[model samples]
Every structure is written in C-alpha cells, then in structure tokens.
Target chain A: MRLWRWIVCLMPGLLSAGEWSGYAELQGRYFPQDAAYENQSDHLISLAFQPEYYQRWDKGNQSLLVVPFFRWDSEDKERTHADIRELIWTYAGNRWEAQAGIGKVFWGVTEALHLVDTINQTDLVENPDGEQKLGQPLIKLSLERDWGILDFYTLIGFRERTFPGEEGRLRSHPPVDQDHAEYESDREERHLDFALRWSHYIGDWDIGLAHFNGTSRDPLFIPRISNRGEIKLMPYYEQMRQTSLDLQATKGDWLWKLEAIHRSIDSGSYNAATGGFEYTLVGIADTDMDLGLLGEYLYDDRGDEATTPFQNDIFVGFRLTANDVDGSELLAGVIKDMDESSWMFNLEASRRIGSDWKTSAQIRLWSDIAEQDPLYSMRRDDYAELTLTRFF
Target chain B: MKLSLILATLLLTPAVTLAMTAEERGLEIAKEVDSRDTGFHDFKASMTMLLKNRHGEESLRDMRNQTLEVEGDGDKTLVVFDEPRDVKGTALLSFSHKVGDDDQWLYLPALKRVKRIASRNKSGPFMGSEFAYEDISSQEVEKYTYKFIEESEHDGIASYLVERYPVDPNSGYTRQQMWVDKARYIPIKIDYYDRKNVLLKTLVFRGYQQYLDQYWRADEMFMENHQTGKSTLLTWKQYDFRSGLTDADFNKNSLKRAR
Candidate 1:
C-alpha cells in the first residue's frame, strides 16, 4: 500500500504536468535496563511522501501551492497509519499574502517546549512511568508583513482524554469514565490562542520575541491556581488559561532563549488544588553560545506538592560537527532533576544521507539519586535505548 | 632596424601605462557583467555531488535536474525539479517585491498539493547543502555593496577582483570575492564567506559560451565546500531568453502542465 502511494506521487511528475517530492527513514534500536525492569527495544521506520502542484494565475502575478503529504510510522503502538502533514493553500500577491490549512504551526523558540521538535504525527507526553498522551487538532491562520508576522489559531474540538487501556481506539470512551463529557469527548470546548511574533536582525544578531495565550497541545505545562483554596470538583474547561512570553537571540553560531509562562486556573476542586496564579521560567542555551555546550534550566514556583520534582531541571550538553560535512552534527547532554535529584544523559547524531534523506541515532540513560523517597524509588530502573532513524 | 624597434616599443609602453587604476577598472568590469545578464530567462541544468565523510568514506549522488523560468524584472522565478524520484516533479514559485518582501511556494506530488515554503527559512541550508535558498536565487546589483580589490592574472587571463558585502541582514554570506574576466566582463570565480567573514566555499565557472551576441553564460559551474570536503557540479544544457515564453508559462497551472 505504501509503495503504491509513492508510485502514484511520482507519476504526476513523470506522466503529467505536476511535481512530486518525498523522503524516507528507517531506524532500529536496542534498550538495556537495570535489574528493576525487563530490557526492551524496538525498531522504528518513518516515511513522508509529499507532492505539490502549482497553478499560476493573473499573468504570473500570483500563484498557489497545493501540497499534500502522507506519513507512516512502524513503531506506533496504536497502529500503522497515514495522514496529511501539511495541507495548505496560499494566495500570494505583490505585497499581501493569505494562507489557510492544517499544518505544523511553529511559533516557539525553545527546542523542547514549543519549537515543533516532535516528529510523531500525534503529540505524546511521556510520563516518568513511560506512558503517552495524544494531541489535538488545530485550525490556523496567519498574515505576514515585511516587518514581522501576526498569527491566530483555535483548536475547536480539543480532546486529549483517551481510553485507559484501549491503545488502538480513536473514539472516545463511555461517559461513565469521564468527569466532563464535553471536555473529554471530541466535540466540546475550544482552545484558542493568538500570538504576535517579531523578528529583526541587528548587526550579527537574529532577535525574536513572541507573546501568546492558551493551553499548549504539548506537555510543557505551567502551574495555575494558588495554595489558598480547598475545594473539589474543579471545572476542566476553566483550567485552560495560560499566557506565555518567549525571547530568543542568535549571533553567529550561538543561540540563547528564555521563556516565562503564567497560568490562572479555577483550582477549587481536588485535594491538591490551590487556586491562584502560578509562574514558570525556562532557559535554554545552545552550542552557538560557546564551546559547543547546550544546556537548559527550568523552575516552577508552584510548591513541591503541586509541581513534579523534575519540574526544576538543569542540564548541559555538547554538540560536535563532523569535520568532513557541513550539516552532520553530534549532540550529547546530561540533565539533573533539581527536585528529584535524578539525572539523565543523552547522545544523538544526525547526518544528511542525500539531498532529501536524513539519518539519525540517539541513546539515553537515566538514573535517580533520591532513592530514599518511595515516590522516587522507580529511579532505580535506569535504562538506555539506542534508536536509528531515517527521514525521507 | 634597431632604431625603429626602439621607437615602436616606446610608443606601446606609454599606451599601456595609460590604463585605469585597479579599483576603478574592477568596478567597471563588475557593472558590465551585471548589466549584460539582467533579463528574464529560462534555464535547465543538472547537478551531481560527491560527498565524503571524515573517515574517508565516499559516495556519489545525483543531486537534481532543475528548470527555472524568470519574469518581471527577475523578481519572480518559477523553478522545477525533475530528478530523484521523490522530488522529481516538485515546483517552486518565488515572488519578491522590488523593495520589501518575498514569498515562496512548493508543490508536492504525493498529496497533489502545494505548500508555502516559509520565508523566514531563507537562511536555512538548501537541501542540507552549504548553499542557502537565497544563494541559488538571482542576485540583483542593489543587494550588495561592492569594492574593487585588484587586478590579477588567473589561468593566463587578466581578471579584475572585486569584494562584495551583502546588504540584507538575513543573507548567509557576509562577503564574496568575485574574479571577472577583463575583456569579456564575465565572472569566472567567486569565494563565499560566512557570518564571521571567514571563507566558507569557492565557486568556479568554466565552459563559457556567448549568447545573444551581448550575453555570456557559463555552461559549467562547480561549488566546493572548504569545510565539508563535498563538491557540487552544475551543467547547463539549455538556456534561452526572450523565447516568447510569458508569465502564463510559469504559473501553478503550468506546474502540473510541466514536462
């Protein structure tokens, strides 16, 4: 089935008047865990086939790009699936432009928090116990100008609640299992966000700033609600208020970024809920800074009971460029969880295989130092996994 | 016979000594080359790249077969790629304002769709090569600040060397040094620099052919990466200007209609 799609994509360029382009990657990995858990590893294969067609209008004064894409992943525990990555239509004139589509809307600068780093079609938040949560659908719009860009988006039917053990189910579970049917089902509540991003180059620096509000589809959550309230049955829809500020600076090969997020939630429900405003700060530094070191620090002032111990984290890493190639890069880093006092070390290497092909491999090992606490005892299951991937 | 020979030599010496300064002559030659090539055109080219790793492993790859049609003071270009099965039929349409901004579009085959390539990505490498998207685009004289370096002889040909600095902040090249043939006013070589003003790559041109009597084109061009040890060679088979092609030929409708 996959092979046929690729052939069909190539046919337009070969047999008709359209063009086609695509890329593919295959990767295998092995995992070794300490005595606490069984060692397990899996191989992954991912492919993206994209083909676009352009139709010129009005004496070559304007044109439109109709690009659709299909992707597949072998390691998807749910099932092997294919869907569009970017389906956007653009109308461009001399000075004005408009686009409408469902594509990856990259709005942030931090690599881990909001930089659109995840390659998986679905958004997954990996918990300490290795569980994953999926993402939601979004409708995006944008207007660009010579000075900067103005963008707005709203995820109309935000549904993150999945069945407890039905890994392959795409539909919602019974109402008995959900506290709020409107929020849990894929038909109620709207996650709206708007941002104004400005980018300017001054001397050798590429500076950018952005301001946004709303809940992020990813797991980089900021705390909301103060510790002063003692109520129950919190409204899930009211927990979605968040404001984010992001700043990034790049000079030469170095990059520095800082993000501060504030959230206000109606936390009057649940035993651990404190209802006020919470703030989190995160900072990231990359090899472009100095000596090929990449590091990050994050802090949340929402109290130890409300925020996870790993919420306060500091890590440093190094990136080495291959001597023979321009884009090949190797990155290694060790992160220390300030709250749990645990540590994680990771190494990744990537190279451009061909004009459109990319290959990469990564290995990660984690350990917990605060084993005295029962909650942190799982840290003893330190493990490592090596993954090899190819991108088409 | 000796007296006649001395007189002839003396006369030619003064004539040679009346030449312009190196800086003045270099600028004049650079302008001449730019003027001769300023027009809407169509081109088809193929490229091959040889890539080597740090441990001496080598691989040969066919990069791309590309066709470009330009219009409107060269501010807009319709580019098509026709090799490497994956992107064999991909087309890119770029529109640039004379004074303000530029927009780009890419048509993919699988989805039967067209996507807008974000403009902010102009600084990113093109297909992971040392060259950025902007590097492959047509360059306007107003985009750079030029200074005459010197007059030098290269490969037995007298050339004028000129230094050029990018006027746009988003440009990947901080500076470039171009060697122009003195008589033909055609660029034969160029050295590209990074943001730090360090030499990053060198491009060499050969197989020059005269077109339209006044225009000169290089049939072969090679870009060598000093840092990566990789090189790409481009060979142009056909280049036609004012071939009665119009804006209608470069539109999105023509993309699916391209051969």
Candidate 2:
C-alpha cells in the first residue's frame, strides 16, 4: 500500500491532464558464451510504464507538462522503482519562452550513441542497470525568433558515487577501512554545468550545434557508504568539455542524418591505498571522437500509429535501416597501463506490419585494432542480438 | 484421378467466386466515386486555415486559390496562390492518370525553376496537415482494393462506409476507411493510418456544393491528430475544372509557362 501511494504521488502529472494514457511493455533475452562460465545463459524480464498529464492555459502561453514513470525488473530480485520523468512549468510570450524544472532535454540526433541523452543513467549507456546515478536538477531557458531557436540550461547539486568496500563485502571480501572511515562523517559534493544549443531549419535540412562544460560524476565510484565499513564515493574531480554538430536532410523517401562529437576529459588525482601511489589524472588529457550516420526510408501510409492494416505496398513491403549504433573508436595513448583502440558496428533490417509493429534482425561486431600490441590489447569481444519492437 | 479433379474444381469454384465478388464490388464503388468527381473545368475559392497546437493555442491564416482541371482518366490541374504574396504566383501542376503512377511539378517564382515532386513521399503530410500526398492525389479505381463495410448517414446525407487498401507499396497509408455520400459519391469522412497500422488521424468534410452541375466539392475539411492535440481546418473556394488545359501545359518545360 505504501508503494502504491508513492507511485501515485510520483505520477500526479500523468493524471493532471484529465486524460488517461499509458503504455506497458515487456522484453526477454537469452545469452550464450563460448566458455561454460562465460557462456552461462540468463533470462531477464523488465516492464516500463509511463503516464502523461498536461494542461494548457492562457491560450497556450502558459502550460504545465508532467510525465511520471515506473519500472520493475524480474531479474533484479523483482525490485520496483518509480520516478518523475518530466515535470515542467512553461511560459510563452510573443518571441521568448521559458521552462523550468526537471525534464528531459535531448540535444543530439545520433540514434545509437547520443552525446546529449545525458539526462539520466550516465553509466548505463544503452540499458538501465537499476542505478539512479544519472540525471540532475536543472533550470532551462529558451528564446525563439522567426529565424531560429536558442536554448540554455544549467544543472546544479549533482553527486553520485559507489564504494569499493560494499561491493567487496557483497562478494565476501574484506571491506575497505578508508571507505568506512569516510562514511562516519557525511561528505557531500556538488557540481554545476552549463550548455548552449542552437537549432534551425533551411529548406530540406535541419541543423543543430551545441557546447557544454561541467563535472561528470565519477564513473568509478558509489555515492554512499554503509555502516558496515563499505565506502560508496563516486570518483569526483573529473571534468569534461563537449561539443557536437548535427545535420539532417530529407528528399523523397530518403532521410539522411550525420553527427559528430568531440569530448575531452580531465580525470582527477586520487590516493590509492592498495598501491600506496598518489596519482593525478589530468583533465582534458585524453580526447574522444565520435562520428555517426543514419538513414531511413519512409513509406506512404496513413500517418497513424494504429488502425493500419498489414499490406505489402511498396512503402510497407520491406525496409532497410543501418546505423553505426555506437561506433566509438577510443584511442588512449600510454596512460596508466592503458593504450588501446576499439570500434563497434551494428546493422538491422525490418518489415513493417501495418503501422504499429515491426520485426527486425540485428548484428553487432566489436573489435580492438591494437589487440596484438602489448601496450594496448585488453579489448576484443563481439556480440549479436535480434529484437522485434512494436511502437504506438 | 478424374473424380478428384472434378471435386477439386467444384470446391474451388465457390471460394474463387466469393473472393472475386468482394473485389469486384470494391472496384465498382471506386469507379462510381471517381466518375462523380468529374466536371469542374475551373474553380477559385477563398479559404482560411486554422492551426491549433497541443496547448489549445490557435493560429489562423488566410488563403485564396484557383484550380483548373478536368475529371476522370487522365486529368491536369493548375493551382495558383493569390494571397500570401510570398507564395503568390506559385503554381502546382498535377498530372494524374487512370493507372500506373502520377506526375507532379511545382513552380516557385522566386527560384524561377520547376521542381519535380517525387511520388515516393506521397504518404507524408501535405502542407503539415493530416492529409497525405497520396490522399490529395487522384484516386483511380485500379490503384486500390476496396471493400464495402456498411451503410450510414453523415450530416443527413446517406453514405456508404468503404475500406480502401493501397496497391502501391510506397504509399504512406496502408489502408483508409472512407464515408462516401450515396448520391454524390464525395468522401465525407476518412480515417488514415501509418505503416505500423496505427490510427494516425481523421478528416471530416462539410459544406458540400456543386460546381458546374457535375462537380461536387467540399468547402470545409477538418483534420485532427490522435496522438498530438493538434488540428488543422482547410476551407476551399473557387473550384473550377477544364479551362482548355492541354498536355503542353503539364509538360516539365511548360511549368514556367503556366500563368
């Protein structure tokens, strides 16, 4: 009953619009490995529910948008969680408008590896791993003119960490004494990040550009320390600077997309008790580059997501789509016993069923080019997965 | 062997006959609707377009246009913009055939060039409305497989509910359900779908009038979105047909010559 009440409160925005709308989905998967231990197969089931509510007043000049979401994974001990995905209050006047509160701000168009879907789950790039380490409270502002649109935002009071001691204890290992010591005194960290984005359309092309700077939650730490000498501190002091460029073009049935991203990171210095080595990870000491391409062929059909029939018309007969999904080739030159370069490729093809359901087969390959070199050879693995998705 | 052959023929005859009857009825209705659409030689109408976003805010614009064309089989239409000078003198030519594919061209005075609009994009929104390029294109009986669903009344007019499935794979709409007036065969209502077979939108027609005795035109059309709380209203005026339009006027080279 307590869980139900919490879910209801978290979803006030969903019913506020006085309309009832929601969707539920379930997915299952199987894995196989060459080695018995590595090849051990497992099954996972997950459910995601979203409810949306909205109200518009003053002839749309002022409005409220709310969406609350919930999820449960059978594989994760049947743990259930709820979150307010979007809660935004908007005010629009003539040429300028502003929206504040917690909501998703998607900045990039790259489908597979979005540099800007950074609202939540910074560590889990493709799937949610039950960790709420991502997402920050932010304030957003925008200005719209006849020519284009400009947007700005700042995120504050951000902290996420993982302690090594708790994980070690969970695995029946010794807990870190330093982590337990830190937990006795409540230690809190804060961060502030800012970004500017611009978007405009010219003829058949839509273009976007953005730049952002801020501290990224330490990817290697946990935020809380347990009383049992478990240290949960996400490595902080690491900062990142990022820039992106995007372009999309549509002609006839063909839609083309191209995007590029450049990121520089400064990994802060930390004390290593195990090795008794004091290390300072420089900021912007390493650079990462990403390039992506996407293409889709749209067929003519009634523009609805439902009530369309299964037909083999030219537009609906068959469709082919391919993306470099997450083709990020990372190059780290001689840094802390880590010098390697890796790349990934993914491709898919699907057949349209009416307008709501589609079945697709996908193949993925991952490889490390410097695997043979002693300086950089710890990265080489390939996996493939096929999925049939239905959209409404 | 002889007995089995005879039995096989006897069993297949009824099933084939039933299938043919349904298809034949659908084709007949399509032809009837197409024929009734004939006769407007030329037309001009003043219109106002209203757009309402999800927030319930409304944006209104005025539009005036003139259309000249014929009906049935192969027909050519010339559309001229009168208001919104930015789009004024922009001429749209549609060459529709009874079978096979249709051709379209747009002449932009600013660009001083005639551009061919591809038919593959016929499923997309037309002028950002629920109506797709395929919906506005000429409807030839052979291009679809139709099924008569039922009989109903709309705005006091007796109508037949018909389902039309596109034969062209490139069409955006997999299937469309239409309400055609019994007397005039003009589509009074239509439901559209996307490739995923989801209900995307609906269009309602009102205020029907006869032009040049044989042509029936709907003065008002309202399109509403199912997912997004958006709607578009189009009011057409001055619909004309057959102002001595010839093949020369529809030629790619003649796009600039169109006045």
Interface DockQ of each model? 0.09, 0.05
Find the candidate with the highest DockQ and give its number: 1
By summed lDDT, the worst window of 10 consecutive residues in model 2 chain A runs over A271-280
CA lDDT of every candidate? 0.49, 0.50
Candidate 1 wrong stretches, greater than 4 Å? A1-27, A34-101, A115-122, A125-136, A159-239, A268-291, A303-310, A323-327, A352-359, A369-392, B1-179, B189-203, B209-217, B223-231, B236-259
Interface RMSD after interface superposition, each candidate = 9.9, 19.5
The reply for model 2, stretches above 4 Å from the true place, is: A1-17, A34-41, A77-81, A116-136, A159-189, A217-237, A251-256, A262-264, A267-392, B1-120, B123-132, B136-259
TM-score of each: 0.58, 0.44
lDDT of 1 at B133: 65
Candidate with top lDDT is: 2
Give the TM-score of chain A, superposed on the true chain A, for all candidates in the order listed. 0.62, 0.55
Q: What TM-score would you report for chain A in candidate 2? A: 0.55
| Quality of candidate 1 docking, DockQ | 0.09
Q: Candidate 1 clash total? A: 35
Task: List, residue by residue over A223-252, the lDDT tens digit for candidate 2.
Answer: 565565544343433465667666655453
- Cα displacement (angstroms), candidate 2, residue A53, comes to 2.7
